[model samples]
Target: MSLRFAEEIILLALDDQSGKLRPLPDRALELAVAGGLLMELAFANRIDTDQKQLTILDRSPTGDTVLDSVLQTLPEGDTSTIRQAISRVAADAPDFKDKILKSLVEKGILNREEHRFFFVLKERRYPMVDDREEKEVISRIRDVVIDGAIPDPKDVVLICLMNACDLSSAVFSDDELEQHSDRINQVARMDFIGQALAKAIAEIQEAILETISYMGM
Candidate 1:
């Protein structure tokens, strides 16, 4: 089965033992999933990006429902500023965590469990059913980040997605991230699509934070 880029990212964020994203922030996970969809479009050659803008290259159906839906809805034009496109897509996206989590459960990669506290408060947990997929993801990240090996384009994109989501601590300790910070950044910069996606993630995060701050005030 070919995993979508978003699926790969969702798997990477999950804990191999528990299948929960314990260390990653909820907000970051949301943005990362949304950004992953855009990255997938870029990978499919449906979109291209420079530092300042994102251009829709071909609006043809990617044969993937989720991706094709997004592509079909994109503004019909040559290009839009990167920030504009990012914000528009993100704002229009459905709840990413819920969507991706459901898909993972359906794939049998994770098992969904429901719990009730005192027979009232309900909670859900997704535990790993098969860990082989996640192991592959970790191996790829390890080869690039820890071994200092050159990353392939896909690996570079994954690294950038992980970093944008602040998920390094989930895979590596603070000490390791600090030691290899420069190297990680260097590898992440190898792909222009990843760079553009990272920028989008940052901008969306900032916008969310600002909104929260304003609401609090």
Candidate 2:
């Protein structure tokens, strides 16, 4: 397999073993192995043996629990040899190793510690709610309302009815509705205005639905 793909598989395998989702170190041997350069090194006396305890030792003994976890995640069979080869190459090829480390860190798959790289599998990801499209959608809705483009009463009512039906079936539970009775009542009071706005929203919604139907949404 290709060195890059092998490196990726090693990371994935380690993560699976360790139950942590962190990037692997940018060892030269790792790059070589990933690039398929390490088979020769593995055969030569230059590399140490592969094993779990040895793998842990190979990584710079820096108390990196996350890194340790990932190393431990590797399967029992190929773990030791791969780990030793990675350690030896990384130790030997500082410049190339550093480059790989930087790439992993920059990609946010690895963290930095005392100039060393650590992996994190469970990286945080923000929800799509903060996307540009969501922002623009909200902005447009506000602009339309503020600009006094009130929708027709029938459309407004239909929109509110749709929301109420959807909420009843898909979102809010009966217990939640009862618990938030005051807020529900306040929202209920806005049904009249919502109905008015719904007319225009309904047209927009219908147009979108029609477009989606044709476009295979």
Candidate 3:
């Protein structure tokens, strides 16, 4: 069972016991999902990106619904500036998190439960049906970020997406994230597409924070 990049990230983001995400602002999770999609395209060689721009290398279907849908949505032109592409994709995918979670649930990797708060507000919780898959994801990330092992290109992409979303502490303990921060950052910078996506995530995060601050003020 080969999980897509987004699926792997979602697995790591969920708590093993509770299946809830670690405390993170909603925008962070949104950006993480967007980043996951971009990384998946990079892994499939469907896209290539540099500091300046993202180029569509292969617009053909990946045969995976989500990836192919995104490929189809790309502009007819071969390239868009990195920020332009990120903004377009992120804007186009307002329900990215929900879509990814739903896919995982359908695959039987996660179980979804609905609940109500005070019998008024409804919410959903996703618990892992099979934790072994999540453990494998953790081991792969640990090998690259903590063990100082050379990572597969896909692992490198995953680490970059995790860091961009501020998910290192969520995936590992606070102490462990701190201990491995340098190595994690080092690995994340190894790919040009990762670098571009990380920067785009940072910019989006900054914009979200600024909006929140202004609203509070």
TM-score ranking, high to low? 3, 1, 2
Which 10 consecutive residues of model 1 have the lowest summed lDDT? 88-97
Q: Rank the candidates by lDDT, best first.
A: 3, 1, 2
Number of the candidate with higher TM-score, 2 or 3:
3
TM-score of each candidate structure, all chains considered together: 0.87, 0.19, 0.90
lDDT of 1 by residue, 1-217 (tens): 5676778887877776765566655367766766778888998999999988889999989988778877765677989877677666666554555677788888888888878888874767788888787778878888899997878788888889888888877677889899999888988888887888788778878888899889999
Best by TM-score: 3
Tell me the tens digit of each residue's lDDT in model 2 across 1-217: 1122222322322222233323422222233322222322222222233222222224332243323333443344433544333344434433443453454445554544432237544343222211233233334323323343454332233224333222222223567546654543333335433332223333434554678788985
Error (Å) of candidate 3 at residue 157 is 0.8
**Model 3 regions lying over 4 Å from their true place:** 92-94, 116-121
Poorest lDDT segment (10 consecutive residues) of candidate 3: 88-97
lDDT of each: 0.79, 0.34, 0.81
Model 1: lDDT to the true structure: 0.79
With a 3 Å backbone cut-off (N, CA, C), the pairs that clash in candidate 1 are none
